[model samples]
Target: MPSLSEVISCLSDYDPNALPVAQAQQIIRDVVTPVEAVEKVALRSALDRVLAHDIISPINVPQHDNSAMDGFAVRGADVGPDKAATLRIIATIHAGGGFDGEVQAGECVRIMTGAPMPQGCDTVVPQEFTQAAGEGEVTIPAGAVKTGDNRRLQGEDLKAGKPALAAGKILRPADLGLLASLGIAEVPVRRRLRVAFFSTGDELRSIGEPLDPGCVYDSNRYTLYGMLSRLGCEIIDMGVVKDDPATLSQAFRIACESADAVITSGGVSVGEADYTKQMMAELGDVTFWKIGMRPGRPMAFGKISSNGRNACLFGLPGNPVAVMVTFYFFARDALLRMMGAEENRLPLMRVASESPIRKKPGRTEYQRGIVATGADGVQRVRITGSQGSGILRSMSEANCIVVLHHDQDTVHAGDMVDVILFEGLV
Candidate 1:
């Protein structure tokens, strides 16, 4: 792997201070490399796991031509376009059963959904489109179906010896079903990433500890735990490390030795106690950035080493909401890359704003929003009650985040604004 300096040298317009959000993301992408470890797991156990190798279909899906609907299978030539056609139902074919009997020109087969199509049949006219003419006869109305309609051709879903799933794909429920259809009992996937995180501050206390006069219980670690767990990472919670330089340095070393990444909330900003930045500089190549973004501005990102073992470090802001925002926008993608996941950015959908929003140019803003369908049936977004970085309730009440672009100014009521939903109706 190339050093962070070498990587940054390649980019002509690299600025640590006042870094653009896109530039910060691109820098992270260029620096991080995927972990190279593979394991074989059962199909059911591979959900959310990143695939290590391309999965080629061993056999065609639906080995034979099957019926897509519960209907009558007949020759397309027998069904005229302008006139109704009547045919005798010679046999019935149920799902998982084979119909070997041939259908003549004036004969049809009563086929259930997923049943193999008869030897000479090409199309299926759904049962609803046909009326029973007699005990063994049915009539298909004109313009009911056309040639090559409602027939699921053999290997239509996955052909034999073809790639079905590519490497780096994070398997979902549908992917598991696809594997089951191909009779894949096990799949090879990348090993889960191990992440170690802690909160640093003299005024921070852990749960169950008595609160001091000005100390507050640390919530960053718990939130980080939840976010990291949802991303399929094995988390090593280091608890709350004090603001002392010696103690913090030891924690960083231990974290680097045990995990692939280390995340710390607080102490990255230009405060009187610059021990975190000083210790980071002594240990590895890290950069402190004042990014051009709201809620999250002070951040530290780079690779750090301890006892010859190195791990990526993401030092986030001290504020609770700022930590969450920075993690979602910056650290999440880098961690996904390290875990060997090939995923695109979450899509931003445009929806009307329920009220005017106060925004300024030059810095991107991510406001917590409640998106819902109004009485008029149009989906609109309203900002949460308090948009403060310390107000954790804002994040809890929000179902989506309204993203205002860096170059965009204030937004008027009813204007289309881009939003990324947190809870989708899947």
Candidate 2:
């Protein structure tokens, strides 16, 4: 296991005070390791679980050569490019049936879709292209389908002993169908990650508690719960912890001892009277960072140990919107790694802006925005009214987060900006 200091020492431009977003992401990836535990799960229960090993196809898909269309199976030599040919229809083959008799020259068989091709037949002409001549003969028009046009070859979909799905893939609906097609009853997958999270502050209260003059209901835990649930983690919601030194220390120790990763929102900023920072430093090798980003800035990342058991730690900002931003951009990938899953970062889309955006050049900004299609079919994005970190309503109303890069200046109207959609993240 590599210490956080050892990892940071290797970086050439390591600055904790104003670390770049990209640099912080890379550091997190380098310091964390994937879990090695595995479990066998039934196919129905394997959805959204990461595969522990590559799935090899046991049998060839489409085991035999079959017809892809309902038509007449005939020899390629029977049809010509310039002239029409008439053939006698000898047999009619349905799906899942085959012809045992040889098809002679000037002879064709009526074949349905998914039916195995008859012996000595290499092409299929659709019923619409051929006209019926007499009682059992059909006329093939010139320039009809070419040879081998409507036939599905054996093992085309999947060959025996070939890899069907790679390891680290998160199983989805289509994956389940593919596994069923290969007759796989169960699969090996990584066990779910155990995550323990809580919010810390004396001014925070639960939902049922009465609102005092300076206290407010704690909303960060609920948001964190929803996000962690979507990731398929075994969550341990530790609720709200006060700012007392002994209470905070006990919470950190218990969280690290019980879960694979510990996440907390609040008590990470500089010059705070609370003992959150001191307790964190005493517990393990943790570093506080003020990243060059908007909505989320103060954060702490490291490994903490208790009773010889250790877990990764992430201390996020206390504001409602800031907590979500920091988690999505930082802790999400780290947790996925701990679960032995592949890198599944949300993709950024470029869309035109509906109006000019005020921005500085040194820091990155994540402004909530709604992406919609214009009357001309072009997609454009406009910021949701105010982007304050505490205004959780804006985050709920917007469909995407407009990402302005660190070196980018003010964005003019009609300029293209990168955005990560909520549909993908949630």
Per-residue lDDT over 1-426 for candidate 1, one digit per residue giving the tens place of the 0 to 100 score: 777778888988888888888888888888889999999999999999999999999999879899999999999998968999999989999998887778889999999999999988999999999988988899999999998789998899999999999999999999999999999999999999999999999999999999999999999999999999888999999999988889999999999999999999998877733766788889899989989998888999999998989899999999999999999999998999999999646689999999999999998999999999989899999999778899988998899889998899999999999998987310
What C-alpha lDDT values do all the predictions have?
A: 0.91, 0.92
Question: What is the overall TM-score of model 1 with all chains considered together?
Answer: 0.96
Candidate 1: segments with Cα more than 4 A from true spot: 424-426
What does candidate 2 score in Cα RMSD to the true structure?
Answer: 1.6
lDDT of each residue in 123-200, candidate 2, tens digit only: 999888999999999999987978888988889899999999999999999999999999999999999999999998
Taking all chains together, each candidate's TM-score versus the true structure is 0.96, 0.96
